[model samples]
Target: MSKLCLVTGANGHLGNTLVRALLAEGYRVRAGVRDTSDTEPFAGLDCQRVYVELLDEAALDRALDGVEVLFQVAAAFRHWSADPEADIITPNVQGTRLVLQAAARAGVERVVYVSSVAAVGHDGSALDETSWNEEVENPYYRSKILSERVAWEAAQALGLWMVSVLPSAMVGPNASRLTDTMGFLESIRQRQVPLAPDFHFNFVDVRDVAQGLIRAAQSGRAGQRYILANERSSSFADLLRAINAVSPGYRQPARAPRWLLMCVAWLQEAQAGLGGRPARLTRSQVRLFQGVRQEYDTGKARRELGFQPRPSDAVLREAFAYLWRRADQ
Candidate 1:
């Protein structure tokens, strides 16, 4: 009998892709979606739907029934809010706890937590499972750090079979046109964005992330964390040029002084805090430029789980192609 895999946040870009991948691999998929009626994206897919919230005990239990593996991909993903700490902190930490508990209660064989590289330390070093970004003075990063801590504690306490996969700057075509990465790419392609940072990030393909999650579910070592980074960390200039190569009108941003950007960030933060609206330059967004360069030691994943990520350029080209086609439609 094929194992039953429950994927939370099944309607999301990554979650939805994961479900499709799981189905392709012959696992029965149970998608935990908040709205059962919004099933158009999952239409004709070999998957069942579980209408539930992360904290809904009864509903969560119902979803966990007969679930041999669980993929915790759901999280409150937002940066600017009146109480960002509450909006991000509670759901991520509490929701993860509840999901793990539900999995343990249901005797699930394995659980894969799709964490972010935001949880890793940004000390200009090649980060891996052992490193973490606990010292960052930002809300979103703090929330991710706290969530990973929660996962670690739960793994130790329940003796649960779990592995954490931390992916950096997930870029792919499926992200909505409004997502941060997609928006950035779109603006760059349209010559609407400016002030590109002179920095780099470990960009991972969303398809690779989906693949890593599946590998984690099957062959991953329990209680371990894996950093899923592409072979090369692309510079902002390189990224701009890559997009420009495809989109004729794509333009690069003029570099701005770091201090000037800091002032703008402060003003944006103050305005949002007082007006209860989204901030232009959130603390997370600010630190993203100032934080340590994102590079990772994927040797562990290679030796253990046979993870071989493609080049960043290849993924970016594919994403650009997909976006180009979608925009034409």
Candidate 2:
């Protein structure tokens, strides 16, 4: 019998990549997704598709049965929810607990949890896997940090080997939807953001992130976390500049003071509240990004998993070309 692996959120960008990688590695894969109608990405590959609703304990428990390794990748990702505690936190925290318990009951050997850089809050220093971010006031960040903690605590109780992989802002082609980096680039293309945040962030190629996750499963220490980020720390303006170098015709957005941006965010959020949808701008973003500069050292991942993330310029160039081609089509 082949080694069995379960990858939740199999339809997502990273999940999709990991599924293919696992199949190539000769592991029998169980793809846990909400929809099976569109397996276009997995065409010609034979695998099992299981419907996974994160909040549904019975469904997740059944999905975990007979799996040797479980990759928990499904999480609620948003800055705001109609009810933050109920919608975001509850589902993520509860879902992780359920998966940890189910995996233990099913006698899974190891669980690899896909965490986010949001869980590691910003300090002015070089971030490593040990850095814990305290910006829990932001609902999305709070949910991720709390959910990771929930997974770790459950892993401790269940005596399961667990490794967490944290990915920075991701850049790649063929996005199924507008993710954070894509949305930011879209804003630049549309010239919607007349003012940009004068902050810096580390980014990684989605391909590298996917590869790192697999390496974590193979080589990461039990109960250890790895930052799957490259040395791509730069400001928003710099990122746009790189895109403009490839795409051209993009004017750099002016930098606005954090206070002024907060006021504008409040106004936009208020208008969005009246319109009964989440706002594009919010106060939480201000707390998270405004005037903040963060970078990470991936020495642990490099030494342990032989993780080698690519440079940002090459990744951003391919991303811009892909987006431009889509625009032309």
Candidate 3:
């Protein structure tokens, strides 16, 4: 009998791809999702489906029963929410704590926690697994930083064999819905973005991240963190050029001035506060990425896990092609 694995948030972009990856490796998979009704992502996939709410301890325990490995990939990934603490922080920090506790109770052998680059601090230099982001203005970033710490704490206290994988802006195929990264690309392709912001983003393929997670589960040292990101960061303009090369007729917007961008972001936030939809651009996002270089050192993953990531241009092109196909359909 193959080892049983349970993947939380199996309907998410990275989670679904990881489920497919695990299935391809011949492991028995149990996909934990919020709603079984939204089965489009799992269509035709041979796997057990279970409803998983991170905050629900009984549900998580039921899902983890007899599982050899647990992949805790669910998190409230929102930059702007009407209520940041309740909507973003509680679900992420408290939810992670509950899931790990339940996994401990269920006697799961190993766990792979999905963290983000947001947890890693950048100080205009290339960051590695050792760096930590102590201060962040964005609620999403704060949640990740705190949640990762909680995961580590749980692992130590419960003597659980757990490893954390930090991935950068994940881009590639197998996305059932438009993620923030994919949506950003679509906005560029449809010419919705009038001016490209002066920001740099570290891009990584979601498939590679999935592979990294598996590798971590197989050989990663317990309590260690692995960063799944490109060696160098790509500017917003670089992303635009990659999209233009793959899909023609979309002009690259010029870089917007920092002051002007901040002013626009402030106005958008004010509008969102006045019973409008969440702002597409927020001050926290602007402050987080404006003129900042998002670079990382992935040598640890390559050397330890034998992880290899695709080029940013290739990732972007494939992502745009996938988006184009989805739009046409």
Candidate 1 on 137-249: residue-level lDDT in tens?
A: 66667778898889889877988899999887777755543456666666666665567665576777787889989998789888889888775577777777677667656
Which pairs clash inside model 1?
120-133, 121-132, 121-133
- C-alpha lDDT of candidate 3 relative to the true structure: 0.89
Candidate 3: 10-residue stretch with minimal lDDT = 246-255
lDDT of each: 0.79, 0.81, 0.89
The order of the candidates by lDDT, greatest first, is 3, 2, 1
Worst lDDT 10-window in candidate 1: 173-182
Report the Cα RMSD per candidate. 1.9, 1.8, 1.0
TM-score sort, best first: 3, 2, 1
- Model 3 clash number: 0
lDDT of 2 at 213: 80
**Tens-digit lDDT string for candidate 3 (1-329):** 88899999999999999999999999999999999899899989999999899998888888998999999998887788778899998899999999999989999999999999899966668899999998668999999999999999988999899999999999888888777777888888788899889878888889999999999999998889999998788887787778787776766677799898999999988888897687778888888888889888889999999999999888888888888888898
TM-score of 1: 0.93
Which candidate number maximizes lDDT?
Answer: 3
Candidate 2: how many backbone clashes? 1
User: What is the Å distance of residue 222 in model 1 from its true position?
Assistant: 1.3
State the lDDT at 257 in candidate 1: 64
